[model samples]
Target: MAVRELDDLDRAIVYALQENARKTSTSTIAERMDVAPSTVRTRIQALEADGVLTGYHAEIDYERTGLQLHTLLVCTAPVPEREELAERAQEVRGVVAVREVMTGQENVHIEAIGRDGDDLSRIGRELDEIGLTIEDEDLIRNEYETPYDGFNVASE
Candidate 1:
């Protein structure tokens, strides 16, 4: 997709939303940016329509939710079929996310949460059934996120 140019107001809105999409209200962003709430709302709608702002996602702590196993399943799928296999991997029970990297080996990375070893084994079996070669499995300790600094253009 072609990149869209974002102005200071657009960048500020995206940054604020990224920081806390659920809690950050349009009014709040307007207040922070000293703009009209309607303007912020319109800009947000435009951003979404333009595919600049895709979706808001919750940061979940799977371990706290009693699903102890947070595993990163590194797998390789035939380059021709990688994207399709990644989408299929998302349907697997216990699978949380599937990332298709632009690499030959270890191209598909699946993040999954399971209660026990058996559950993880089942997930792996399902993935294999769909023609992904499981290269390695690593337990995820923690993940952290921060909003893109480039979106803080208003501050700069």
Candidate 2:
């Protein structure tokens, strides 16, 4: 499929929506960008159809939600087994996301949230059983995110 290019108004709309998708209505976004609400709606539908805007999600504070332990597991496996290992890691309890890194010594990065250290330990053991050798792991102390600006959008 051909890549659909986002126009200037699309970039502004995206930036506004990224700030707060649930609260930001099409009319609000259009008003901010000085465009019609119908135009904004059409562009948003087009963006979704072209797979540019995949999905809207809420950023939850896992720590506040009682899942206090958050970790990043850097593991290595044989190239052929890397994808399988990632998929297996997801099946392990507390494991949320498993990203396969194509290049580097650590081929897999697992993002896990747990109730405590024991929960994380169990996940680690499960990964080990799946033929993943944990090179290193880090406890996520905190996360900081900023509103997405239109910096990534190409200028016309």
Candidate 3:
């Protein structure tokens, strides 16, 4: 697929959505960008169709929901099977997210949440069953995110 080039308006729209998609309405973006609401809506549709904008996800705080352990499972999978195993790992209980890195080793990173050590062990075992060699595990303390500044049209 050809990459879709984004203009200033598209960048600004993406920046606004990244800041708060749920609260950022087309009308609000229109007001900020001085464009019509319909124009903003059309741009958003185009962005989605082009795959520049994916799904909007909620920022979850697992610790507040009783899942105390937020762990990063560093695993290594054979390069040929890495993608398949990463997708399969998502189906494992307690697994929240899986990332595939383009490296020779420690190429798969799995994010999982568990109530305690026993739950984490089960998740680890399940990952191992799926052909991922567990290399290390780290308990996450905190995570933070902010809108990408490059997409901030005002900055340009």
- Candidates in order have lDDT scores of 0.94, 0.84, 0.95
Q: Judging by lDDT against the true structure, name the best candidate.
A: 3
Instruction: Write one digit per residue (lDDT tens) for candidate 2, span 12-55.
Output: 77776677888889988778678899999999998888888898
lDDT of 2: 0.84
Stretches of candidate 2 above 4 Å error?
151-156
The number of the candidate with the highest TM-score is: 3
Instruction: Predict model 3's lDDT versus the native.
Output: 0.95
Ranking by lDDT: 3, 1, 2
lDDT of 1: 0.94
Ranking by TM-score: 3, 1, 2
Candidate 1 vs candidate 2: which has greater TM-score?
Answer: 1
Error of 1 at 137 (Å): 0.7
Model 3 per-residue lDDT tens digits across residues 1-156: 889888988999999999999999999889888999999999999999999998999999999999999999999999999999999999999999999999989999999999999999999999998899999999999999899999998987
TM-score per candidate, chains pooled: 0.96, 0.85, 0.97
